[model samples]
Target chain A: MNKTEYLKSLSNELGHMPYGDVKDIIQSIEEHFDEGLGEGRSEEEIAASLGDPKELAAEFKDGVKFNQIMKKRKRLKDYAGPDGRGRIFVILFNAFVGIECWLLLLAAIIAAFCFLAADLAFIGLIVAGLITGTLTEFMVPFIFLILTLACVAVFLVALLILGIKYYAKGLKSYIRWNKNIWNYGLGED
Target chain B: MNSQIKKGILDLCVLALLEKGDSYGYDLAGSLARKVEVADGTVYPILRKLASEGVVSTYLQESQNGPPRKYYHLTDAGRRKLDSERDEWIKFCGEVNEILERGETGGKADE
Candidate 1:
């Protein structure tokens, strides 16, 4: 009997899998065929090597069903919140960084304008104090310098921490995602 | 011989026999039993799988003794698979030998 006829009958007997999955299974078998042909083996010789297709199909079907179950489990995990609201914490943390970035930018701009305005105010104060004949006017320049340096330092540190955390979160998600999938596949029947 | 390994290879052995020519279930089982141990029911499942994968085909024929017998024949696809698996076995064995020569596991032949 022809291979096509046998495959058709088998597909009918199995009641057909998802169309995409069926195509994938067929493609894997065909790959074996191509590899055999490349090695100069005849069709008859190669066909006998694979043993039974039913067992392989069973293995494939089991794997697919297992993946679906794992996907559902992941959805549940996202809602259930592992490690005492770790997912919620991550979400809030990300939002905090976004808002922090905008605030920092605004602060820096205000600080810059204030520094300029403070310099102008200090000059004005010194001039007025000079006119009034006071010696305590020199303290204004020192105060403005300290405030600008402190605000700038804080902004730089926040941005740097945000960048590092972004990368860390990305790597963390990748490892956890793969670990969950692996565990699911291994535990499946 | 390791039973697990033998059992795993049983299906391959049966397919190899069929590579020679088409035969019914009884003859195939008998031929395999001579060379290796096999469960009475092992061949049936293997046949079902092979037929399902389009590697083999079956047709019923009336016989003289009691009832109609089912005959199995290998298809082109099945032959191709057998040959490729046979090559893989050869390559895998060669690598195992190399590992053994390097004194790995004291040359224990366990897969």
Candidate 2:
């Protein structure tokens, strides 16, 4: 078969594919023929080497069909939205269970800060006692008490910093999880 | 080789060839057909598939003797895929050879 006949047959066989794809395939094949002819090969030789137009068309059709199905599946997946029951369950769980857990965490964090403030206040009271000479009668014991209090305050400060850091991280991840459930349902990464 | 088997490996082969350097459709088809028993037209569909998958990209370059040729270049994704697919192919071949060699020994022992 000559180049024209070969392309004609291939184009006819590719009737099921989109026009753009068919055009592109035909153009590429035509260029293949042109390249062959440029190298002093006959149209018939190139056409023969390319195999049957029907078979080539079948390959192209299969590839195109597979791609179309994949694209359609992706579109369907996007259109599916989050499952209603799953979303409702997530919402209810967040409202009833998750909210209580979050509130408890908030309360714990606040209580921790309160304790840290009280430690600071105690340290201030010790310093005041030292400055006013009220604790001069028990100077040695009072010094030891102030040093112990200072150590406790340092430890509390460190604990509060770490606790706040982890709490913020956990809260951020929890919010992300809720958003994911709301948008993509369960088990969809 | 079975056509089905050949079809599966053809994609990998095309990617491997492109990984070497950018090549036009005709050159790729010629090279593949020389080594494998595929028709010259077979590579086009695979190229289209790879292009659609974003593993390979194509550009038209002016040819000195003929019309502009569409050159296929391997993308980064294509290279990574080649590495993984090559490893899998090697492992698969090893397993197949072992099984075939065992079968051969079994057949010889029976004889």
Candidates in order, TM-scores: namely: 0.35, 0.63
lDDT of 2 by residue, A32-151 (tens): 999999889999999999999999999998898888788757655786766786689788998899999989988988887888888889889888998998887888987888899889
The pairs that clash in candidate 2 are none
Candidate 1 lDDT over A1-189, as tens digits, reads 234543553355445466775664454345344444555776555455544456545545554565567667765566432343444444565577744754675576566556655655655665666567574556677456656655665665565566456545655665565444443432322
Estimate every model's Cα lDDT from 0 to 1: 0.59, 0.90
**Chain A TM-score for each of the predictions:** 0.37, 0.57
lDDT, residue A165, model 1? 66
Q: Which stretches of candidate 1 lie over 4 Å from their true place?
A: A1-189, B101-111
Tell me what TM-score chain A of model 1 achieves: 0.37
Q: Candidate 2: where is the Cα deviation over 4 Å?
A: A79-189
Q: Which 10-residue span in candidate 1 chain A carries the lowest summed lDDT?
A: A180-189
Top model by lDDT, which number? Answer: 2
Lowest lDDT sum, 10 consecutive residues, model 2 chain A, at A180-189
